[model samples]
Target: MSHIVSIQTEIRDPVAIRSACDRLRLPEPVFGEVKLFSSSATGWAVQLPEWRYPVVCVVNAAKLAFDNFGGRWGDPKQLDRFQQIYAVQKATMEARKRGHSVIEQPLEDGSIKLTVNVGGAA
Candidate 1:
């Protein structure tokens, strides 16, 4: 069995989001941060910081999705998500190094999630 998680916040500044994404690119894939933007019924947006390529990221995102919408645990799905995030994070880093921007669109169901900055010299 698996667990579900939900992420909720209210901060949507395009500049801030872009800056955060840029800063996140400085780290390695295992410790890159990803921001999730969510909106309430009234169109209010929230920014959520998450780890982009970690097992915890996938598990947490699924938890949030499941919490919002009732669902059963699917480990395979979660693992697939982890892989996707990792690949994306790696690609994002490479793109950023080449002076490109990373834009991750939000999901309609409000399950948007990402990774946190890590993999720094620790």
Candidate 2:
């Protein structure tokens, strides 16, 4: 049996998403850019940035898993994880589309900092 693993990324801009995809050497059309906001004790906002092509990050990952693991990723749990990661990637991309720079470092805090700046600086 083959095992497949995909690293998570935080990017909220279409441009940034494209750059990341290139950096990761992943295929195109990772996802769409859209702002998602949820209100709670700690209000949180999420965004999924648009891609240059007609590709969804989630879908690409599924394909990659199948290619790497020989269909083992068909398992429901694996699919769920793929979807969750994809959602996060999309949200990150959206944030970048809104002119917010997302910087994620290895730390306990799951929060990512968005630096708003004029012009593109990714």
1-90: candidate 2 lDDT, tens digit per residue: 323334354323455444544444445433434222221121111222322112233333332211213333234443343344444466
TM-score per candidate, chains pooled: 0.29, 0.29
RMSD of each: 15.8, 15.2
- Which digits, one per residue and each the tens of the lDDT, describe model 1 over residues 1-122? 22333433222323332343344442222223433323212211212233222222222222221111212223345433433444455545555666655555557763434332233211
User: What is candidate 2's CA lDDT for residue 112?
Assistant: 33
For model 1, the local distance difference test gives 0.34
TM-score of 1: 0.29
lDDT of 2: 0.38
